[model samples]
Target: MDADLVECRACPRLVAWREKVAIEKRASFANDRYWGRPVPGFGPADASLLIVGLAPAAHGANRTGRMFTGDRSGDFLYAALHAVGLANQPTATRIDDGLELRGTRITSPVHCAPPANKPTTEERDNCRHWLDTELELLKPTLRSVIVLGGFGWQALLPVLAGAGWMIPRPRPKFGHGAHVRLTGTTTIDLYGCFHVSQQNTFTGRLTPLMLESVLASAGRTAGLLP
Candidate 1:
């Protein structure tokens, strides 16, 4: 079922651009076929922690079927996840690379690759249904959400509020290890960190160690590790 969604072509514009990029980079990902459509969420479905990224990169996850894979952003993210003991492997170069995630899952608010890495408000609204369904399926056992960047956090804030939980006073801001605890039957923790995109990493906005520390704290809060 999840596999089918990865091969989906529901968004025509996304499909065309994805194919165009794949063809342009033919030599690099020669044997690699573009997942090129809508990249589905990755990691354990029953995970206690959900890591929400902004969106797929043009040549990254948009080309590979897996989330946060085949891109520079993924390189930093996977390294951090592995350091925190959530991933069995530290490297994610392809879709079928046999990497495994433990007690964690990674997803994006927008499934399709957007032009210039920015999705319009309408596009994000259109994709919200998928995220809603995803949260519903995982809500039973979900314990925490780690939003990767301001955009990802913004997209999820309303969803949490709509679930009958009151948001914190002053609201939670997006920063490394910034967290909020919801007032509800099951308390869910929200943490924020800078996105692991090339711009951020290259500019030293988010260091590798900083990201690893955030994941380490999340694992502890969710009881996935000590």
Candidate 2:
């Protein structure tokens, strides 16, 4: 599954931007090779907890080929996962960093990194196929989800509905700590969290304790922790 995702070139703009960043390498990582491809969701296929983010970071995941790797955003996320006993380590530096997640998986709505960290609506829609397939495969064990921002929250609604989860007519609004459970052939409880971006963490818009609380709640909801 990951093999196919890495080879995707469906979005011309993303294809160009990702490759450009790989070649123009960030000064700090000038000596390193960049993955410069779509990053697949990371964790066991039967994970009970799924985390969805907006997209890869131009110099972060785009460089390491792993979601949130080599970036401050990953630092904030993995640390919280570790505190909840969902991650083996509080660091996600590279694909082979020896860090691992248990009972939880991390993915993005947009696989490829976008210019200025924003993927246009078309790019997001074009990328939905990957996420749709992923959710279908994870349906059996996926019991809870944590959307990392408004973008992910919005992107996941229709995907969940399409996948057989009944969505509310008015739709739930996105807010930190917001949670709703959908019932259909399968039930999945969704929780919202502020993105672990520097803009949120550094500004105290999202604090360590706050993020941990939501993760802990999801962990309990998924029966990953007591």
Compute each candidate's TM-score over C-alphas: 0.92, 0.99
Candidate 2 lDDT, 1-226, residue by residue in tens: 7889999999999999999999999999999899999889999999999999999998899999899999999998999899889999999999899998999999999999999989999999999999999999999999999999999999999999989999998999999999999898778899999999999999999999999999999998898999
Candidate 1 positional error at 5, Å: 3.7
lDDT of 1 by residue, 75-148 (tens): 99998888889999899999888899998988888888888998777777777777877887788778888999
Highest-scoring model, TM-score: 2
Q: How well does candidate 2 score on lDDT at residue 82?
A: 94
Which whole-number lDDT from 0 to 100 does residue 215 have in model 1?
89
Off by over 4 Å in 1: 1-4, 7-12
Candidate 2 residue runs with Cα over 4 Å from true position: none
Kindly give the stretch of ten consecutive residues in candidate 1 with the minimal lDDT sum.
Answer: 1-10
lDDT, model 1, position 198: 89
Q: What TM-score, to 2 decimals, does candidate 2 have?
A: 0.99
- Distance from true location, Cα of 225 in model 1, Å: 1.1
